[model samples]
Target: MDLQQLPGYLTMALPLLAYAAFLVVMHVGQRRLGALAALKVPLHLAALGLLLRVGAANLPTPWPARLLPYSEALIIFAGVVLIIRAVDAIGVGYLLARLQKRHVPHILRQGAILLADFIAALIVLRQYLNLDVTSLVATSAVVSFVVGLASQDLLGSVLAGLVIGVERPIAHGNWVNVNGMEGRVVDVTWRRTRIETRDGDFILLPNNVVMKDTVTNYTLPSPLHRVRVEVGAHYRHPPNQVKAAMIAAARQCPEVLAEPAPSVFLESFGDSSINYRLNAWTMDYGRQEAIRDEVNCLIWYQFQREGIEIPFPIRTLVAPPPEPSAHEQRQDQIERIVPLLLDSEVFQGVSAPDLLAVADRMNLLTFGAGEMLFNEGDHGDSLYLLAQGRAQVIKRTPEGGQALLATLEEGQCLGEMALLLGLPRTASVRLERDSRVVEIKADLFRELIRAHPSFLDHLSRLVDQRQRANQELAQALAQQKTADAAGGIGQILRKIKSALGL
Candidate 1:
C-alpha cells in the first residue's frame, strides 16, 4: 500500500467500517428497543461522514476541489438528518411514555437536540452554501404570513396537540366524555384524537375541538367510576329489606368493586311504590352496560325470591258492584283453614270431622308479602299454619342484618313454640308472598288437650321433635348450639294442663 495515500485509503476504509458497525447497532437496537434504534442511525451516519470529510481535507493529496464541496455537503446533510430524527424520536418516546404511565423527559432533551441541530445546520449552510438563513427568513415575511393564514386551523390543531402532549390532559385508555360523546381514547395524533365510543364506533375529534370542548375524563384521577341505577318497588316491603336486596344485587356483578362497596338509597315514595337507587363502583366503562344489566337481572331474581314486589302502572275502569254476603266469606275462610289444619302434623291424629270442627274455630288471617307476622321476642299466643304462599323465618344478626333461618311454604307451620310453651317468639316471621294462615290459639289447644288425655302424648312428642329439628337447623348454619331444647314435651303438657285446670 502507498504510504502517502494512506489517509485517503483510511478515510474510505473507516467509513465502510463505520457503516458496517452502524448496521449491526441498528439490527441490535431494532430487535431490543424498536423505534428507539432509528434515533441512533443518523448519528452513526453523521459521524462517519464527518470523519470522511475531515480525513479527505487533511490528506496530503487532497481530493479535487469540485468534489470537496459535495463531500462536505453530504456530511452536513447527514448531520441535519440525525438532528431531526433525534428531536422526533425523543418527543414521540416521551409522549408515548406519558400516555402509558411510563416515564421519559421529553421537552428538555428534544429542545436541546433541536437547538443544536439548528445551529449546526446554520454553520453547515454558511460554510458550504455561503447562505445566511436569518437574512432569508427576514426577507420572506410576506410569504410566511401567507402560509400562516392558509394553515391557521392546521397550525391551531398542531399547537393544541403539543399542549395535550406536554400536559397529558388525556391519555390512551382513558374513559372520557367529549362534548356530548362518551368514549375511550384510542389514540391521539398531531391533528386529531381517535375515540372508540360505547357503540363500538371510532370517532375522530380535531385536536383544537378537543381542547375547546367540555371534557370529562372519568379515568383521570382514578379508573374506578361510580354509577347509579333507579328502580321502583311496591310499598309493602320495608326500606331496610329493599336496601339489603339492592346492595346484594350490585355486589353480585363481577365488575363491581368491593372495596368502596355498593350502596342503596331511598329516593322517594311514588304514587303506588317506593323509588330507590343503587350505586356501585366499576373500572370497566367498556362493559358498563353489561355490568348494569347483570346487576339489574340479579336484583329481579332476588326480588322474586324474597317476595319483594315490583309494581307496574295500572289503569282502572269503573264497574257496578255485585252481591256481597258475609256467609259466603265465612264459608270460604272455613274451607281455607280446613285443609291447612289437616296438613299440619300437630293435628295429624285428629279425624277429618274433628279437624273440620277445629278449622271452623281457627281464625283465618291474611298477610301481604314482606309483612312481618311476628317479631323476635314478641309475645305470641298462637301458632300459624301457612295455607297459601310462603313465609320466611328471619333471625336478626349481631351486625344489624337479618339472617334467613328457614322458608315455610303452604301447609308448613310457624310460631308453634308460642302456643306450645306460651313462650315469646324466638325469631321474626315474615310473609314471603300473599298468604292466608290458620291461627290456632293457645286457648284452642288447651281445650283440645283437655278433652283427649291420650292426645296430649302425641302433641308433646310432636313438640319435642320440632324443637330438636330447630336445634339441628341452627347447628347446620354454624350458629351457637340451641339452649335447653330437651323437655319441651313435658313443659308443653304441664302448661296445657295448668291452663285448662285439668
Candidate 2:
C-alpha cells in the first residue's frame, strides 16, 4: 500500500477492529445479563461515530467536503445516545425504591437520563467540533421562548407531570377516585396519566387536571377496605329483626371478615320503608363490587325468608289486619317439629306418644344466621334437632381461627353426646342461615331414655360413632383433638349412666 493512503487504511481498519472488540464484549455481557441487550441501538451508534470521526481526521478530508461537517454531528449524536443508555442501565428508579422505601416515578428517572444526554451532547459539540457554546446557548434561549408561546398548554402539562412525579402522592396500580371518576392508575406519562376503569376502559387525564383534581386513593396505607351495603324494609317489620337479618346476611358471605364482625345501622325512616346500612370488612378490594353484590343478594333472600317486607313508594289505601287462630299456630308448630324427629335415625324407636311427650318438654328456638348454638368448652345441657335451614360445625383452631368441620341441614341434630353424657360440647355449631330447632334439655332426655330400656344401647352406640367421627375431622383440620375423660367411650358411658341413674 502507498504511504499516502496508509493513514486512511489504518483509520478504517482501526474502527473495524474497535467494532469487533465491542461485539465480543457485548456477547459476554448479554449472556450474563440479558438486560444489556437493550443497549443495542446506542452501541451501534457509538461504533458508527468512531468510524466517521477517525476517517474524517486521518483521511486528510477537507472542511468543504459534505461528509466532513456531518462527522461532527454523528459524534455528538453518538455521545448523547451513550449518555442516555448509561443512565437507563444504572436503574435509577430501582435504586430510589430501595433507598427511600417507596416507588420512584418513571418520569423523574427518564428526565434524569434526558438531562444527562443534553449535557453530554453540548460538551461533545463544543470540545470536538470547536462550536461556540456561549453564542449557541444564547440562540437556543430565543428559540425556546417562541416554542413555549406556541405550546402553552403543552408546557403546563409537562410541568404538572414533573410536579406530580416529585410529589409522589399516587403510585401505579392503585385504585383512585378523581372528581367521581373511579379507576386504577395504569401509567403516568409526560403529558398525561392513564387510568383503567372498572369496566375495562382506558381514560387519559391530562397531567395538569390530575394535579388540580381531588384524588381519593383507596389502596393507600392498607389494602383492607370496608364495603357498605344499603337496604330498606317496610315499617311493618321490627327494626331489630331487620338489623339482625342484614347482619346475618353479611356473615354468610365468605369474603367478609369474622374478626371485625358485621354491623348494621338503622339509617332513617323513609317514605314507605326503614332504611338500613350494613358494613363488612374485607381484604379483597379488587372484587369489591362482586362481594357487595353477594351481600345484597343474601340480604334479599334473608328478608324474604323472615317475612320482612321491603316496601315500595306507594301509600296503602287500606291495610287489612288478619289474626292467626290458636289452633292454626299449634298445628303449624307440630308439623314443623314432628317431621324433623321422625326423619332422624336415633328417633326411630321413639313412638308417636313418646315423641309428642318429648316435644312438649322441648323449647322451639330460633337462631339468626352466624349465631353460635354452643361453644366447644361450654357445658352442654341440651340437644338441638334442626327443623329448618342449615348450621355449620366449627372448631376453634390453635391460631385463634375457626375451622369448619361439617354442615348440618334440616333433620340433623347436634349436642347429643354432651346432652346424654353430661360432657362438654365437642364443637361449636353456628347457624348458617335463619333456622328453627327443637332443643331437648338433658333432664327431659334422661327421663325419656329411662322409659325406653332399649334406647340406651342405641344412644350409646350413636355417641361412640359420633366421637370417632369428630376426632377424625379434628385431625384432618389440624385442630387439637378433644380428649375423652380418662377411659374413652367406657368412661363416657359410665358418666351417661350416672347422669341418668341407670
Candidate 3:
C-alpha cells in the first residue's frame, strides 16, 4: 500500500469491512432480524456494483469510462435501499417493540423509500455522470402538473389517505360507520379503505369519499359502545314503573355492562303507546345487533310479568280481539300454579284449600334462555318454583370461575333455604330455555306457615334432605367438601321460626 494512496485505500477498506460485518450479523441473527432480512437484496446489489466497478477499471480506456457511471449508479441505488431498510428495521421493529406494535404506516414507509431513491438518482446524474439535473427538474415539474390535472381524483384520494394515516381517526379492527355502510376496518391503502361488514361482504370506499363522509368510530376513545333499543307501552302504565322494568330487563342480559349501568328514557308519548328507549353499554360492537334483540326479548317478558301492556297501532283495518281482564288472567295463572304447588314436597302436608290460597297469591314470571334468575350471594326474599323448562345451578369457585352444581327441572324449587332462613342465595341459577316460575314471597310463605304450624316440621325435614343431596352432588362435581348436615332439621326449624317472627 502506497503512503500517498492511504486515504483512498482506507475509505475503500472501511466500507468493505462494514459490509462484511453486516453480512455476518445477518447470518447470525436472521431469526431476530424480522423485516431487516430484506436488506439481503441491497447487499447483493452493492456487491455486484463493486465487482462491476473493479472490472470496468481494468477494461479498455473508452469502455472503462463508459461503464463506470452505470456501476456508480447501481451502488447509489443499493445505498438508498439499505438506508431505508435500516430506518424501518430500527424505527418500527426495535423502537415499537416495547409497545408490542411492529407496524409502520405502509404509505409513509413506501413514500420515504421512493423519495430516497429519487434523490439518489438525481445525485448520480448530477455528481457522478456530470449531467445537468436543473433541466430534468424543470421537465419533471411540467409532467407532474399534467399528471395532476388528469388524475385529480386519484391524487386527492392519495392525499386523503396520507391525512388518515397521520390522524389515525380509525384503525384496523375498528368498528366504524362510513356514510351508511357499517363494518370493521380491514385494510387501508393509498387509494381505498376496505371494510368487512357483518354479512361477510367487503366494501371498498375511496379515501377521498371516506374523508368527505361522516365517520362514526365505535372502537375509538374506548371499545365500550352504547346501544339503544326502542319499545312502546300503553299510556296507562306510569313512567317510573315502565322505566324500572326496562332497566331490570337490561340488567338480566349477560352482555350488558354493569359498571356504567343500563338506563331507560321516556322518549315521547305516541298516539297509541308511550315510546321509551333503553340504553345499554357493551364492549362487543360486533354483537350489538344480537344484544339489542336479547334486550328486546327480555323487555317483552318483563312487561308480561309486570302486567304492562304494549299497545298496538290505532290504524288497524281489521278489529283485534280484546285482551283478557286482570281477574281472568289471575284465575288462569292460579289454575296453572295449583298443580305445581300440589306436586311440591314442601307443600305435601298442607291441605288442598291452603295450597290453592298460596297459589292464588303467587306470581308467575317468564324468563328467556340464558337469563339469570339470581346470582350467588344475592339477597333473596322469595322462592322460585320451576313450572316449565330447565335451569342450571352454578357455584363460583375460589379461582373466579364457575362450576355446575346441579340442574333444576320442572316442579323443582330454588331459593327455599334463602326464603325460609333469610340467608343469601348460595349459587347462581340461569335458565337453559324459555321458562316459567311461580314466585312465593316471604309474606305469603309466613302466612301459610303460621296457619298450618304442623307443616313446618315436614318442610324442615324435607329441606334438610335436599340440602344434604345438594352437598353430595356439589362435592362429587367440584371435589370440595361442604358443611356437615347432622342435626340440620333442628337448625332449620329454629331459623324458620326466627325468620318469620313466629
Candidate 4:
C-alpha cells in the first residue's frame, strides 16, 4: 500500500478496468446496436494485446519488452475497430429509428466499415508506429497495379454494388425481373445479389450484370402492381358490351384491387375476332399467375353468359358441320332440363305437358367456381335449380360478416321466394364448383299458371312447404312468422299473381 507502488498498480489496473467497462457496454447494447456482434475478433485481440503489454512491463524478460511494439500495434488496431463499430451502431440505430426501417443497405454498411478500417490502419502505421506510409505506398505501386488489373471484374462489381446500394432501385423482398429472370430479392452483397425464384430456386447474379441488365421491379414506388390480361371476343358484340363484361370479371376476382377500378380497352381487330385488354391492379405479385388464371376463367364464364363468342381461327377452308334445326335444339335442351326438373320436389305434381313447356322456356346458365349466381339484395326474377355443381348460400349477418346458411348440391333450388314475390335476393349464392343451373324466369311461371290455374295452387303449396321445412332459408329470406300463420300458401299465390301481373 506504499504511495510509490500505488501509481504502478493503478497503471496496471486502469487498462484492465477500461476493457471490462467496454465489454459491459457491448453486452448491454448488443440487442439495440447489432453492429457490436462484429467486434468479437477485435475484442479478443484487445485482450491479448493488453496481456502482452502487461507481461512486457513486469515479466523481467528482454523478449517480452521487445514484443511491446507489436503488442501496442495490435491494441491500436483493436481500438480502431471498436471505435468504427461504435460509430456505425449509433449512426445506423438513429437512422433506423427515424425511418422506422429494419436496416440500412448491406453494401453501404460493410463498405463504410472497410473504408474506415483502411484509413485507421494508415493513420496507426504513420503516426503511432512512425512508419513512412507514403514510402510504403510508393513501394507497392507496381504490385497494386497487377492485383487491380487481375481483379478488374471484381472491382467493377464492387462499384456497381455501391451504386445499387446508393440508388436503391431494388431491395430485399422486392419482386423483380432482370434479363427475363423473375424472382424475389433475398440478399444484396458487394459482389452478387441473391434472388429466390417462385420455384424455390436461388439465383446468384453478379452486381455488374444486374446493373447492366434491364430490371423491372413490381414492388417499387408502390406495392400495387398492374396486370394485363388479353382476350378475344366475337366482333358481333359491341366494344362497350365486351369491355363491361371483362371489367366485371376482373372486379369479381378477389385478388384484384377495387380502388383503382379495373379497366378494359379495345386493343385491335384480329382476323377472327376483336382483341381486348383488361388492366387490373393487385398488391400480390407472388400470386400473379393464380390471379391471372382466375380472371381468365371468370372472363370465360362472363362471356358465356353474355353470348359472346371467342371465335376459332379459320386457318384452312373446311366444310363446317350443319347446324341443328330449331326443333332439334329445343328437343336437346328439353332432354337436359327434364332430368333436373323431375328430381326437384317443387315440380313434383306438375302435369307432363306443363313440365315440358316449362322446360322449353327455361335457360341453362353456366357459372364458374367462386362466381356469384346472385348476390344478396339483387333484384332477381329467376329461380335457379342447381343441376351439376355445389353452391353456398351465404347470408349477411347483422354485424356485416357473412354466414354460410346452407350448401346446395345437385337438384337443389334457390331464389324461389325472390322469383315468386319479385323481391330482392335475400342471400348470396356462390358456386363452389363449376355449375349448370336451370334458370326459370317469371314469364315461364306466369305462362304455366295462366294455362292451368291449378298449377298456381300446386306451386304455392310446394314453395310454402319447402320454406317451412328449412328455417334457415326462411330467416335468410326474412319471411315473417305472421305471414306463415296467416295462410302461407294463399299469400304466396296472391303475391305470385301480383308479381307476374296476372
Candidate 5:
C-alpha cells in the first residue's frame, strides 16, 4: 500500500510514457497501411502498456514488497481485459447489426455499447482495487438524489434521449420539417440531433426538445417523395380540362414517375381561379423542387396550347395606364431584344448591328412558375433565353423515370445544346417562378447564324466551356461514387484524404 516508499516514481512513469509513444506509432501505421489492416493494433497497445507497467514494478526498488507482485499482476491483467473489452465492443456492433437487421438503429446501439463498456470498466476497477461498489453506490445514490433535484431538466433530457433512441420516430437522412426546421437529417447524436436545413443552416435540437416537438420525415424506409404544384388557370377554363391539362403536364415531364403517375386534385375554387393540385412522385428530396419546376412549366404550356389562360395574381385594382408613345414602344422593344441577343451564346462574336437585327426577329414571351418551357424528347427548333425566371433541367433515369439534375436560374439559357448538337432534347426544362423569357424560333436562330459568321466561333467556345465544366462535375461524381463504394464514413474520409493528396 506504501507505493511512495518506492525508490522513484520516475522509474514507473518514464517506461509508461515509452509504451504510450509506441501505441501512437502503432495507430498511425495501421491507419496509413489500411484502416482494416490493423484490427489488433489497440489490443497490442493495451498489452504493451501492461507489460511495461509490470516490468516497472519488478525494478530493483523498495516498492510494496508484499503487494507489488499481486498489484502489478492484477493491474496488467485488468489492462489486458479493458483492451479486450474494447475489441468486444467492436464485435458487439457487428452482432447487433445482424440481429437488428440494421433496423435496431444506430443511436440505440451506440448507447448500449457505451453502457456495456462502462460496466466492463467498472468491473475491472472494482475487482482489482478491492473497491466496494455497493458502498460507493449508496453514497452516489444520496448525492445523485440531491443533484437530481437541482438538475431535473438534465435528467429529463437524458430520459427523453433514451425514449427517442428506443422509439426512433426520426431517423437519419430523413427530409423532416421539425419545429419549422425543414431539411435533411445529417446525424442523430446522443444528446442532440442535427438537421441541415434546405437553406444550408445546421440546427442542433436537443433530444428532449425533439421528443416533445412536431416532426415530419419525408423519406423514412425509402427516398420516394411527392411534390405539390399548385396551379390556377382561368376560371372560364373547365375545371376538368384544367385538371386533365395539369396531370398531362406532370406526366409529360420526364422527371415525374408514372406508376405513382401524376394525379390532380381539385384543391379549391377561388374568386378568380379554380386551384388544381398536381401531385407527382420523386425518388429524391434534393431533386423534388427542381422536378416541380419542370412539371409546372409543362402544365403552363399545355394550358396555353389548349387556350386556357393562366391567371395573373392581381388584386383587380387601378385603372389601366395610358398607352405608351411610339418612342417608348420602340425603346421597350429594344429592351426586350437586348436580353434576347445577350442570351444567345451563339451570338457573342456577332457584330452589334447583326445582334440587334437578330434580336428584332426573336419574340419575347413571359413565363410564370409552373410553366413548362419544354419537355424531354420534345422536338424543338428554337432556343430559349431565360430573361428572368428560374428553371430546372430534368433528367430521366434509363429505367424510364424523371429526375431533376440541375436548376437553371435567371440569365441561364438552354435548348442551345439541342440546337447546336442537332439531337433530340437532352432534358426537359421548366420555370420555377413567375417570370419572362425570349424565344428565337428555329428558322430565325439559323438565319442569324448564317448572317453572322462570327456567331459560330463564339458558340463553339461556349460549348467547350460548358463541356469542361460538365467534365469537372463528372470527375467529382466519380470520386464520390468510389468513396461510397469503399465503405462507411471513416473509409470515405480516408479515400478522400488519399485521393486529394491530404
Candidate 6:
C-alpha cells in the first residue's frame, strides 16, 4: 500500500471520486434549478464529468494489475442501467398505479426501476467472482416464507391493495361514499386508501375492507344527486294543494333544474297532519344539505301565502295554562287595543289624547279551530289584533279565484285597511288553528273619527287617485270618440305640435 507501489491506483480512484463529486453537485443543482431546469443543464454537465472519468481510468497506466478492473466496473454499470431501462419499458410501475387507483409519483416509478439495477449488480458480482448464490437464495427464500406465514394479515392487505390497484374501483381525486362515509380519495398507499371528508377529517380504509365493502364513486361519469325535504301539512287542507305549492316553489328556485322537474309525494298521515315529501334534483351534491335547507326556508314562507299549515308535533294539553294574575290580564287587554291605532287617520291629523281615547275602546276575543268569523265582501265590523296562534286572510279575485294573502302570527293586525275606511271587507277573516285575537270594531273607530272631523281632509286626499271606475270609463270613451272623429294620426300630430309650441 506504499504510494510508489500503487500510484496508478491513486490516479484512477481520484478521477472516479471527482466524478462522484460532480454527481453530488448535479443533485444540488437539481434542487436549486427546480425539476424542469435540472433536466436541461445540470444533467449534461454531470454526464460530461462521468464520461471524462471513465475515459481517464481506461487508458494505459504505470500502475499495478490489481487496479485495472475499471473495465468490469463500466460493463457492470451499463448492464445494470440497461436491465433497469428494459424493466421500465414493461411498465410494471404503471400497472401498479392502475391497480391501486392512484397516480404513481415519478420518484416511486424510478425506485421500481432501481430494483432492476440491484439485481443486475448482484449478477455482475457473481460473474466476476465465481461465488455460488444457491445457498444464499435458498436461505432467503426460507426466511421470507416464514415471515409471510407469521404476518398473514399484513400480506393479505398488501395483496388486496395490489388487487385494488389492478381493478381500480376507486381513484385519487374521486369523490366516493364507502359504508356511509362521504369523502374524497386522498391517497392509496401500500396497505390503505385514505379518504378526506367534507368536514376536513381523514379516514383510512384498509385495502381489504375497501375491496370487500360497498363503495360509491361520485366522480365517475357524473356526480349529480337529489335532496329531499319533508314537510307536514294539516289534514284540513287537501294534499294536492300543498304538493302543487311546494313543486311551484322549488321550480322557481334558480338552483333546481327544469328537466328533471321537482316532485312531491304524499308520504303518510299522522294523527293531525299529512306528511309530504319534496324531492329536488341537484348536480352539486357537495352542497346537497345546504340546498335542501334553502329550499325548505323558501317553502315555509310560501306555505303561509298558500294557506297550507306546516304541522309540527303538537303538545296540546287538556288542561289550560294557569290563569294569569289580574295585573297580567289588564296588561294583556291593553295589548289588544294596540292594533286599533291603525284605524286612526285622526292620529295622522290630531295628536296624542285623541288616539289614546280611540285605543281605549278596543276589546280582545279568542276563537277555536273550526271558526269562520267573517266573509269576503261583507261589511268590515272590526280590526282584529292577533294575540296567539295563527290566522289566514282569504282574498277572492275578480276572476273568482281564491288565494291566501297572509298568515298572521302573534302581534300581527288584520282588517286595518277595511277599518281605516268605512268599506266592505276585502278578505274573509278566519281563525287559523285556534287563535286569540283582539277586536276593535268599526263603530268605535267611527266614534273616534267623529270626534275629529278634520281627519276627513287627510283621508280624502289619500284616496284621491282611487275614483269611481264608471267615471274613468265615461271620460275615456268621450276622449276616444273625439280622437277618432278628428282622425287618430292628425290628433297625435296636433298634440305633439302643441306640446312643442309649433
- Over 4 Å off, model 4: 1-36, 47-61, 95-106, 126-130, 140-142, 231-242, 265-276, 300-502
Clashes of each: 0, 0, 0, 0, 9, 5
lDDT tens digits by residue: candidate 2, 357-439 = 66655678887777888899899777889888899998888899989989998888888877776767768999888888888
Better of 3 and 6 by TM-score: 3
Per-model TM-score, in order, reads: 0.49, 0.52, 0.48, 0.50, 0.50, 0.44
lDDT by residue (1-502, candidate 1, tens digit) is: 7898876677667766767787787778779987755556466656666656655665555464645775676677676777677655555555555556665333334455666665776777778977887896576777878988999988788778777878878888898999999999998877788999978899999889999999999988878888788889998787878988999888888889997999998999887789999998888767778888888899999899899998885644649587558767777888777766777788877767766666667888878678998999898778888888899999988899989999988898888766665666779999887787778877677667656667778876776676567763334323422345444455656765654455
TM-score, predicted candidate 6 vs. hidden true structure:
0.44
By summed lDDT, the worst window of 10 consecutive residues in model 2 runs over: 473-482
* Cα displacement (Å) at residue 193, model 5: 1.9
Ranking by TM-score: 2, 5, 4, 1, 3, 6
| Preferred candidate (TM-score higher): 3 or 4 | 4
Which prediction has the highest TM-score against the true structure? 2
User: What Cα-based lDDT does every candidate model obtain?
Assistant: 0.76, 0.79, 0.84, 0.84, 0.69, 0.66
Candidate 3 all-Cα RMSD: 16.6
Q: How close is candidate 4 to the true structure, as a TM-score?
A: 0.50
For model 2, the superposed segments whose C-alpha errors exceed 4 Å read 1-69, 72-80, 91-95, 98-102, 258-260, 283-285, 304-502
RMSD in Å for all candidates: 11.8, 14.6, 16.6, 15.5, 25.9, 16.8
Q: What is the lDDT of residue 50 in candidate 1?
A: 63
Please, what's the RMSD in Å of model 4?
15.5
236-345, model 6: which lDDT tens digit per residue? 88665788889988887778878688999989988768998999988777677788888888898889898888766785556867999976776666655554454433
Error of 6 at 95 (Å): 14
